[model samples]
Target: MPELIFRQPDGSTQLVSAENGSSVMQAAIRANVRGIEAECGGACACATCHVYIAPSDLLLIPAAKEEEEDMLDGVCAERREGSRLACQITVTDALGDMIIDIPDRQY
Candidate 1:
């Protein structure tokens, strides 16, 4: 399992264990981490699970697909080079200690 660190908009952080092969959104939902609404339940249909991956961890995970990229256009937060949909990032050993920042609002 990999450990994920979520940095909330309020400057608080939630650390959770993510099972390999599971989506980051799934782990956040399981741990009840705030800021990740996951309205589409990891379907990549919505931007509610938007997160900013740490620049250092960017290469650890695969790049977002076209569908996820398209959905990101609707995110309420500013989209940066590190922005990614949590539902599109699968937990893997390569991502041993990933850190993501949640926006202030998803809606």
Candidate 2:
């Protein structure tokens, strides 16, 4: 299992273990992480699971698919170079430890 560190808006952090092949959003949901709403339930149709991946870990993630990019345009927070919908990020051994920052709001 890989570990995910979620930095919340209030500056609190929650560390959770993620199963391989599960989305980061799934791990957050299971851990009751506060900021990831995941309104569409990891379907990639919503931007509620938005997060910013740590820059150092960026290369470990695959490029976002076109559909994910489209949905990203609707995210509530400002989209940046490292912004990603957590549901689109699958956990893998290669990812090791990932630090994701949750935005102040999801909607």
Candidate 3:
């Protein structure tokens, strides 16, 4: 398992263990983390799992594909350079202790 640190907009952090090969959204959902809805069930079909990659951990994750990029644009919160679809990030040792910030909303 890998560790995931989720940052809330108010500056608090929630740590959760992420199962290997599961998407970040799945990890959050399983942990009952409040920010990730994963409405599309890791299919990249929706933007409900939108998140912002912490710059320090950005390179540790994979680049987003075109479909994910398009989906991200629909995220309810304002987007940033680090915006990504959490459903696309599969956990791995390389992503250990990976940190991400949840947007204000997922709709």
Candidate 2 residue pairs that clash: none
Give the alpha carbon lDDT tens digit for every residue of 1-107 in model 3: 78999988888899999889988899899988888888778888989999999777778887889999889777899999899988898899888877789999886
lDDT for each of the candidates?
Answer: 0.90, 0.91, 0.87
TM-score of 3: 0.94
Q: Could you tell me the lDDT of residue 63 within candidate 1?
A: 84
Worst 10 residues of 3 by lDDT: 54-63
Candidate 3, which segments miss by more than 4 Å at Cα?
none
Q: How close to the true structure is residue 98 of candidate 1, measured as C-alpha lDDT?
A: 73
TM-score for all models, in order of appearance: 0.95, 0.95, 0.94
Which lDDT value does model 1 have at 58?
91
104: Cα error in model 2, Å: 0.4
| Higher-TM-score candidate of 1 and 3 | 1
